[model samples]
Target: MPARTPWIRTFLCRSDNIGVLMRDPETGACAAIDVPEAAPVLAALKETGWTLTDILVTHRHADHVEGIPEVKRATGAKVTAPAKAGAAVPEVDVTVSEGDTVSVGALAGEVWETPGHCADHVSYVFAEAGVVFAGDTLFTLGCGRVLEGPPETLWRSLSRFLPLPDETQIYSGHDYVGSNARFALAADPDNARLKARAEEAQRAAAEGRFLIPSSLGEEKATNPFLRAGDPALAQGVGLAPGSEAERVFVALRAWKNRF
Candidate 1:
């Protein structure tokens, strides 16, 4: 069942990618975030019968923006993308940046610049809907590979959203939850929350399901990436019990890269 307020539809795309829709039932307006592919977005639009009013692009990766032209051509929706990333994406009618506000009918979204996976990556926070489309920067129990970094750069991006309200929910670009779970367990073997989350992800993956719409509070308690500062994690990693948070985080990222 769709939520009562802003009804969100999750579209599973090619490979493990995802495309999402946030619909305002009262206004009958829908905003599509990061078109991984057009067919799935179009299918979802048809299934929901919602009018596409806006397309918010989070990053410039081909897999994320390749379907933009097709979807915009079909719906005539206004397309918004990061100003720095506009050159790499297609049909960006409006270029936005951090603190910029975007509207989908009556709904509003705040743009957050979360680069690391790529130099031009951005994430969209639909404050009214309590959701953030983290693109490739942040995931369920993992983060994007530092394709363009010093580890600190990516760590900064991943840590930016930590201050969001506890109720904030995260929707990422791909379904890597199960594998991330395994990695988290390997690193933080004794965390009850991590163990339970790992088991849940295993069961869900076994059933061919993705664990998404992960809440910020849930992440705070279980996600090792976000818990890099925890003394327990530092001890687990043998990086000195009182190491700096950023140091612990860097070590964790290094370990994850090799994992």
Candidate 2:
């Protein structure tokens, strides 16, 4: 557990993407993980009455950085992005790499270079806070596409999360849980746990609820991409039982590409 309590607020933007506001209870310091748009982010800051202190950008995609300039103008927050991104994102006050540290008031977190979703993509994990801003690299029941790398690189990036404590909470870049759940069920049809989750995800979407903040533990069980090494997953995808983990992983990504 964190020395200071961590407060996270999740909201949607552009009808699909997930935007977040993080506050450190001890210092009243706040940060936005990725800004899909500005209206809701501004509104959340207003509602919480917390002054923004920083912008932690996960990737250089337009949807992630499109609202950065506007939000920065409004909050005057310092912006940090992947060092490799260079000029890809606007107004980077700090460019960080694999081992960089990000601080919010007295609270701090580590940078993780996750470039498979796109070259120079990154994610942040405040281990003490027990949370991660996964950006587009990972989601509830799915992961990002291989736009900039092969399945092997993505597998390595995704594998980084497996060693984290099960209690770590995941905040994703988008609200694609419903569709990911459908694809998971298709590939791993006999997974009763997945069957139950698919129905739950469908019901939640039907009721218009946000499904972005799932735990790493839940993802271990429900995300087939994460379970690609399991013999069961290999067979589910019609691979021979002893096929390599990367093979199952590559096949899974291919199936998701068409999903």
Candidate 3:
């Protein structure tokens, strides 16, 4: 891993979508993680005075890929999308799969095929920078709904993140901490760490500051989805004690869907 960290700028886009601009300070090579909208992205570029060199697409969702055409036309940046997305996403200049590396100047991010939110979903882990752009696969307190895959599939995808360093910065696609906190509390009410986190979420909301870039360590400690392996969580979800982690995860996901 590189010793230097990339300069990161996080902003909101299109309602609740979290937009990120990651730049390598050494070379001024900047990448937009996903384009929720073009106007704000272009404005951010102008505001920061950093030229966009790449658009690292996370999935084929309309909200994520809608701004690609406009942004690409404006900056001529190379667009890299998931190979599994095929033609579902537009204006793709390159396609990447698992183990592929994407470079933004001096920084490199490894591509992980993390489906479950959708069959084409992927995540970008900049190990050198200790950050992961976790599309819709994983979120702050909750995880993405299993829209295109089974709950087990989604759990498997989430498992991929567990092995990262505790300090790894996690950048998810949306700012759903408010709603997610409610569900998390319902599912894991007795968790002291979760209670504290929920209060912090409230404080962040009051200040208009989002908890977008959460740490992997914090998620492990408090996120109900990540803690599904705990026997207590299985009991909370009405499952018998000692239920498999995957089963507990399915129960939690189902409850969240209705919650």
Q: How far is 54's C-alpha from truth in model 1 (Å)?
A: 1.1
Candidate 3 lDDT, 1-259, residue by residue in tens: 4477898899999999999999999999999999999988999999999999999999999999899999999999999999999998889999999999999998989999999999999999999889999989999998998999688899999999999999899999999999999999998889999999999999999999899899999999999999989988999988888899999999999999999
Model 1 spans > 4 angstroms off? 1-4
Cα distance off (Å), candidate 2, residue 158:
0.3
Question: Poorest 10 consecutive residues of model 2 by lDDT?
Answer: 1-10
The models' CA-based lDDT, in order, is 0.86, 0.89, 0.94
- Give the per-residue lDDT digits (tens) of candidate 1, residues 193-259: 8898888898888887878879888888888889998998898778888898888988888999989
* Strongest candidate by TM-score: 3
Each model's TM-score, in the order given? 0.95, 0.97, 0.98
Whole-model alpha-carbon lDDT for candidate 1: 0.86
lDDT of 1 at 98: 86
Question: After TM-score superposition, what is the CA distance of residue 77 in candidate 3 from its true location, in Å?
Answer: 0.6
lDDT of 2 by residue, 91-169 (tens): 8999999979999876788999987889889999888888989999999999999999787898899999999988789
